[model samples]
Target: MMASRATARATGSFAAYTVSELTSLIRASLESAFGTIWVEGEISNFRLAPSGHTYLTLKDEVSGIRAVVFRGVGKRLGFCLENGLRVVCRGRLTVYEPRGDYQIIIDALEPKGIGARQLALEQLKARLADEGLFDTARKRALPSFPQQIGVVTSIAGAVVWDIIKVVHRRFPLADILIFPVTVQGQLAGRDIARMIRELNTQRTSDVLIVARGGGSAEDLRAFNEEQVARAIYQSRVPVISAVGHEIDYTVADLVADYRASTPSAAAEAATPALTELVNRLQSNHTRLAHSFSRLLQQWWAKVEALNVAGLDPQAVLQRYLQRVDELETRIGVCVMRNIDRVKEHVLGLCQGLGYCGPTKHTVRLVERVSHLTLRQDKQIVSFLETKSRAVESAGARLHALSPLAVLERGYAIARHWPSLKLLRAATDARVHDRVQLQLFNGCLLCKVQEVQQ
Candidate 1:
């Protein structure tokens, strides 16, 4: 009995020591596993919650792992988080206390190779800059008063309407042409490029604006495509790019002749306020009138002075003649003092028609009248000539801008007969429908006898 009790006591002591050692080892292992690790992957399933926490999945070619960057760490990240972006993340592996599952708690993140989109943008910018596409010298100045503005954008999008409204508000005289095209998805870039080329070839517009409203990176990707950028660079007409919000930048923006912060801004840049221009013109007219009036007054003063000086020349001649007559009379008075001197002098004056002669004054009055009449006639002729030239020049300019000029240049305008609106396509007229054909000389009204397939 004594030997069995001693064995039982020894077994209990050994069991307690084993349990304590295992517990210590497990604690140490947990500590080692929870330390920091570096991971590289493309971002996916990114979510930023209202609670200021971010959750995302990082995946490589084979596997993905869940990660969370609390509000504190997320706030420290300078760039925006987006899916498909390759990045390197620094974080620690930890088990969620509630679910008891391991996840990465990201403390920091940096773009892997500067991010794909950013790298592509930088490379394109460099290439275009080298080709002088982005050179300020190559950029065409926006028209101060564009008569016809063409817009290239999606037909269904609000951006087109926004541009129209803004342009109308700023310059009602400007004619707007909407060139509808796809602005998103796979074929959007090609559609835009095609429209730009067509407008350039036709010379249908004074200026072209490629525009779209703001959206996420993917939604705005069509504007960043190289094809669209090349189209903008190759355009014969000046192009204005209005792709997104003020902070956003795209390849089209860099290649375009001008960049506007938004669609409305693009419209504003394309045209000017008619009302403000009118006000400025009125102000200038008033200033010109004031300046002309001052000049006229100065000229009138000079003319009046010349007329007074011419009139006084006769008075100067009269004074000199009077002095000579007085000297002769004084010399004669000493020789024949009382031999009827007063009577003889009176007879001589009567024969000479007096010192201030009516004949000379009459001649001066006639000359002055003739001079004034000649000046008035000259002024009238000059004014009429100036007005006639101005009218002729204005008529020539208006004729040049007339739509009929296009028809005169070997072009025909097809219009719907009933509505008299220009027909853009042959489908606008039916097989039996009548249509109006406007040629250079005259209009021809024709009824379709047969439809051609």
Candidate 2:
């Protein structure tokens, strides 16, 4: 049998070690063997310590392993670690020297199946949604045919290359302005955002293509960044986000004007095909030419019909000569007839002149004026008499309702002297408050002594 190091520790003569020394060796061997590995289990007894260390046990039906994620790694985890949540943890395996036990020191964590990147994506999506970044109202429509397309993506990748190829092939007239940017890692988000802003400020593109090729969730993190999403939202030009595969989505994709499943799709969406445009132009030209030809033919037909009506200028001219002789005879007859009719009309008008004379009209007008004056005078008198009676009746009723009438019956009215407020009950006058007793003759101001209700 081989003598193990742990067993040799028992025999001091054979270079034995203390308990602490043995634990250190075991910890080093375990860490070295499993530098970084993934372990899957459901979390149990999850606890966050006051010292900012998370202590938890990862367990399956058969066995369990202890794990601790320090404050640094825990902060990076987008989701909260809770009891019974199934997860896959990545870290170095080693023994805890103080407890003389082996466990994993978690460097990173991911939820099983769906992965850890989703947690960050979900958190960002929720945050952006609350700010109304995903509202359909904020999205703009892309230009049907963009004069210039601004491409924001990494030039080194196939993404920009595909966009250029597609745009050039489909619509050569559209100018492609490439705003190269990093598409991944920590700095990628800032670069992407900066380029988007630059394109907007300069108005470089009629429409923008924020593109990238397919990538893992982690590799696509830059597109999910709030900065990139906000930049897309704030862009004046319409933006089409072509990020990752068809199955993937990001904050940028949601915030952009349109989402393309691939870079080629984005190019196709941004502009119309040149061939289709040419075909439409050709059709329009044909319709216009046909219309012009039809109009010309109609005018030509009218001219030919006029020419077909055979008539000599001499024959038409003789008709005019005959008509002139007829007009000369008509002028002689019409003049004499018109002069007779004029004389008859003038004689009749002379007879009617006296009927419309001023003297006759004035006498008739004076008679009408006298009759109207009599009618007006009678109406005014009748109206005045009725108004006078109404006034008298109203004055009599007003006298009866007057408060002074009650004083005339020997019933006095008591009012607060200073305020002139009528007092109906003794409770209204406080002791020593000055009161005014209004009688038919005069008013007497007095102070309240003993009140009786």
* Whole-model lDDT per candidate: 0.86, 0.89
lDDT of 1 by residue, 353-403 (tens): 876569889999999999999999999999999999999999999999898
Alpha-carbon RMSD to native, per candidate: 32.0, 20.5
Stretches off by above 4 angstroms in model 2 are 1-74, 80-114, 295-453
lDDT of 2 by residue, 29-104 (tens): 8888878899999999899999999999999999999999999999989777889889988888999888998999
| After superposition, candidate 1 runs with Cα above 4 Å error | 1-113, 310-453
**Clash count (model 1, backbone only):** 0
Per-model TM-score versus the true fold = 0.45, 0.46
- Clash number for model 2? 0
| Candidate 1 lDDT | 0.86
Give the candidate number with the greatest TM-score: 2
